[model samples]
Target: DAGITQSPRHKVTETGTPVTLRCHQTENHRYMYWYRQDPGHGLRLIHYSYGVKDTDKGEVSDGYSVSRSKTEDFLLTLESATSSQTSVYFCAISESSRSGNTGELFFGEGSRLTVL
Candidate 1:
């Protein structure tokens, strides 16, 4: 397992508030990803970074932002958290996962956030 840590493992907040989730890794992998899990929709990507300061929005990026200032840290922020954003957020690290090259996604324990 990779050395990954997520802060504030559990949180409760009201609607229209802001929230930030931090992901730290010691594996020094080049790629890091943020995803949210919900019932029906399963797991959806919020954002990902390939390198320091190089990030791209994912399919479900609305109201969400991400930053990667260092190789081992990735930050995900919710500008204005809503009730619908309540879900378990996961931070994943991978060496590579494109084309013929196969890579495994190592996920953190997860951060559960609830909005009222």
Candidate 2:
């Protein structure tokens, strides 16, 4: 719960429209991540940012994009909404995990998006 906040926690949009989700944190953590959760797929990473303006694509980043201009904020956007992208999106923050240590990720509640 590391002071993470997500906006527009619930949204419904039509296909082909643009959608954006905002994640704001006060923890000043170095790593921020975006993930989507769906039935049978658990949670899949969409994108992640390691530092200010430094980001990378993840396994499920086909239609998603992300940006981090500051340490406490991260944004995820879907260029064009699709039914397949309708899912619960989560924002997580974590520090580097070390060997033999249990790595923990603090996640925001969630942002649910529906594409109709």
Candidate 3:
């Protein structure tokens, strides 16, 4: 696919540290989101950015932040890593051609994180 790619597919971190994940897209999508996926909880949106330099907190924004200064890049940062944050993170892009709902998303392979 000619969509998006995430860096550092896997990571292991200690509690009380900092971590940042990168998401790069090729299609120059307008909507980008950073989400954490767990077994029981599915996907929890940490943050979402609509346009460049415009972002808002989502359902689970605590201890996490995001920035999108360019059209193709969005970064997610965990201020203080925690054991509870151990999960698979996914970056996704939403786009629509015919223009209805934008419909579905294309996701990166995902980044696995473990905190001990």
Candidate 4:
């Protein structure tokens, strides 16, 4: 398992507030990803970074932003959190294989957020 940690395992905040979630890894994997798990969405990608300062948006990235300043850290920020953003956010790390990305990911426990 990769050494992944997510801060503020649980949180509750009002709508329109800004929230940031931090993901830290000790494995130094080449790739990191943020995903939100909802009842019907399974795991939907919010953003991902392939290397330091290299990031791209994903399927559900409208209200989210991400930053990767170091190999071991990735940050996700919701500019103005909304009720629809209430979900379990997961951080996953993976290393690329010789041919390509292994597509295997080790996930953190998860951060649960609620917007009232």
State which candidate has the highest TM-score: 4
lDDT of 1 at 63: 93
Best by lDDT: 4
lDDT of 3 by residue, 1-116 (tens): 85799987999999999999999999888889899999999899999888899999989999899999899999999889999999999999887466554647889999998999
Q: How much is the lDDT of residue 116 in candidate 3?
A: 92
Taking the tens digit of each residue's C-alpha lDDT, what string does model 2 give over 15-98? Answer: 999999999999887889999999999999999988899999999999999989889999999999999999999999887555
Model 1 spans > 4 angstroms off: 96-101
Per-model root-mean-square deviation over C-alphas: 1.9, 2.1, 1.5, 0.8
Q: Could you tell me the lDDT of residue 39 within candidate 1?
A: 95
Candidate 2 stretches greater than 4 Å from native: 96-103
TM-score of each: 0.93, 0.92, 0.92, 0.97
User: What digit string (tens of lDDT, one per residue) describes model 4 on residues 23-80?
Assistant: 9999989999999999978999999999999999999999999999999999999999
Clash tally, candidates in order = 0, 0, 0, 0
lDDT assessment of candidate 2: 0.92
